[model samples]
Target: MGYDVDCDKMKDECGVFGIWALGQSEEAANFTYLGLHALQHRGQESAGIVSTDGETLYVHRAMGLVADIFDAGVLAKLKGGAAVGHVRYSTTGGSHVKNAQPLAVQYAGGPIAVAHNGNLVNAEALRSELEAAGSIFTASTDTEVVVHLLARAHPAAAPGTVEHLVGSVRQALGRVSGAYSMLFLTPKAIVGARDPMGFRPLVLGRLKGNWVLASETTALDLIEAEYVREVEPGELVVLDASGLRSERLFPDRPPAPRLGRCVFEHIYFARPDSVLFGRSVYEVRQAFGTQLAKEHPVEADVVIPVPDSGVPAAIGFAETAGIPFAMGLVRSHYIGRTFIEPQQSIRHFGVKLKLNAVRGLLKGKRVVVVDDSVVRGTTSRKIVKMIRAAGATEVHLRISSPPTAWPCYYGIDTPTRQELIASTHSTAEIATYVTADSLGYLSLDGLYAAIGAERTGFCDACFSGQYLLEFPRRQNHAPLRLVGG
Candidate 1:
């Protein structure tokens, strides 16, 4: 099987977009398509859309890019006044057409569709329990467990009733654990829910007096929607003909004392233009760079980012350090999933295919490289060598985020702790491994300062090894130690 050549970085699970135009003549599916297109960076393996025309749900799902999977014909066929869409990169399920989402089904509560953007830590256990109770799942994704849960919740309620649907969603979500930012589309309404801890991002917006839900504000910008506000952690907002209404998933329990918003969203997953947790993602990234510069001051002739993800931080570092900033490396945007492996003689052919050093700008310069994070250190090593080959006199490495030492159980695709270089190696050792003259990572305190939030409000589990929820323990895998307790 061909693997992603650039697989060393962390990957988000998926992106979700939903729109409710109830009595309007808007093309909900088309708006959803545009929103998904803007969120395409969050997930690229597959895309799907489901819409309801008040009585029936229409779905078009395929294993490909959103643009490739949807066209005028497909959108026209998805006739509806409300719709939900998903772009997926599997974290809890195998990558295949069967797992493409906006999972639509008919149940005791009538036809409903779901688009989910996070992982359920207890999915295996839930799947087992459901199976023992005679639930037959068509897909292996953790998201399917949710559909079944909703299908079984409030079995006594009359089907097709709003009360039944709302009760089913609340009851179903209350039982699941771990990160989730979900959207449910029914004949009557579109509902958006966030996990109580708020490990994932979901936001609300307004487009022509209608309600729109998206994983990021960038999607809202693409659709020209007015930015409303973030869907509060633990809150459920239902959008329908009567308008938006809020409910608490756990009506009795108080909200989590410290919301566990994923810190990595601002660092890498979200588009720089997005507003996450009421902060501009671009501004936060730049602050991370500035903080990194304050913590690790290195004398260098020029500072260059790793491109795209690294740009904002690099700019911040350069401005704060008073060093010349340049695009010393140029990245190719067209590299696809498939590529023929070159002979072993072709050193670093994979990395070269995606990035090339600008010899004219980098040669003879004391180059400081800024990157978002280092995973296994293999890619960083290659990048370092590439810069050296371009005649950089000295290569200093600076990372915007602290070392990621633990695997994420909440939707991000990360390597096991054993595979993470930082999990076992120290900063000096990692510098030597990556062949950098020196290395620095933004301190945890500096990170929180840049975010302008209390550490208690966000989840830095990947860096601190403090998981908010207990995850399933599998044989042969070491038990994840949760430091939150």
Candidate 2:
């Protein structure tokens, strides 16, 4: 009966935001709300923020969008000069209020909170160790493991200080393994750190003397913050009333992993306006379209995108390949990712609910439909069929990214290899399944060329099946690796 956020596309796990000011008069709670609103595209299942005004901590977390979870009165009650916030799209745990973050826990260091934007490859191993050591967990999230680890790592008798708090969590992080861009919120300071491999994006910014940290620069732009720099790979950033300082979390670290950044961020996860991994998301997507045109050229009357996400790439493809672009497929903007079918009599049901073919334009035209990526082939198949039913003479499907053949372990939530159409079927077989006259996916080399980066310098695990973390290769299990080893 109510609205729920359920995206059919491959979704990133979450986004994080934090703000801290010393003598400045910024309302952290209000600004954080705006930052999260800008990042609402990153996650929509749950939202939360924890605030601290030097002594006490206030937290509010619930299931739904940022606006649905907070109000003027709620933020006013969160009266603090510093805060940490998160919008979640569960990767490690189920969707529930208990699994929502900035997971606040009371330890020897008073009350500390953590907001994370990644998955832990060794979370199961760490949880087992903690449970064996008699630790109790209230949530089914990998983040809870950090809470217990910090408690055990800290000196039980010492009162928690900013330095001690960061140092303790740094040691704990050293022992765990996986991709994480995290913020540790304590009464004294907010400490931000990234994994040694830099698998996710996190940025630093300053707004009217207030220091800020976020998963994307777009968040900073929404609040009029001056863009700082990225939280460097393996770096620890500490922000407080005095200002911001830095430390390295992986000085004596794992074999200098050549490069392990996530490429999917550019392909689909990040907002088009966001600058990530040293390039504009919009530009990279356009490149994907250009490359797709080069790799697979088809004579067609018009080039049409599969609605919103594919628009940029489709435009590039049309321009490069010398084809006219048209809005052959119209998307219902009001349809919020998920909706109840108004009636069962509607044809092509679910897909039609979100997208409808423009019969007037598509009729009698040989059209090329471009999309960002093909995960299961279900949506692509539906779109192809719908176009044909709309009277298109021929339907050709073009994917900007490579075939998603492997599962992602770092931060992305992907289907198993058995479920990924590419992993189980050949290119020809996939085209037949989708009922397209022709099909083409950008090559892995073509993707790197699009991004202007060396193939070895990024994480294309979902496409290439070359994962970074060394874990036990088992069904649905990439056995966890120790971070401190």
Best by TM-score: 1
List lDDT for all candidates, in order.
Answer: 0.91, 0.86
Clashes by residue pair, model 1: none
Q: How accurate is candidate 1 locally (lDDT)?
A: 0.91
Q: Could you tell me every candidate's TM-score relative to the true structure?
A: 0.98, 0.95
Give the best candidate by lDDT. 1
Residue 442 in candidate 2, Cα distance off native in Å = 0.4
lDDT at position 400, candidate 1 = 100
lDDT of 1 by residue, 1-485 (tens): 34466767997669999999966954999999999999999999999999888988999999989999999999999997899999999998898999999899888788899899999999999999999999998899999999999987874567787777788898899889989999999998888999998989999999999999999999999999999999999999999889999988779887786788999998999999999998999999999999999999999999999989999999999999999999999999998755676555654588888889999999999999999999999999999999999999999999999998888889999988899899999999999999999999999999999999999888998998888888878664556667452
TM-score of 1: 0.98
Residue-wise lDDT of candidate 2 within 1-485, one digit each (tens)? Answer: 33232334797679999999744653888999999998888888899999888887899999999998999989998877899999998899998999998999888778998999999989999899899989999999999998888888754336668877876877789878878999989888999999888889999999988899999999999999999899888889999867989878866756445668889998888899999988998999999999999999999999999878898899999999999999999988766656665665653476776789999999999999999998888888889998999999999999999999888878788887788889879999999999999999999999999999997667888887777777546666443333322
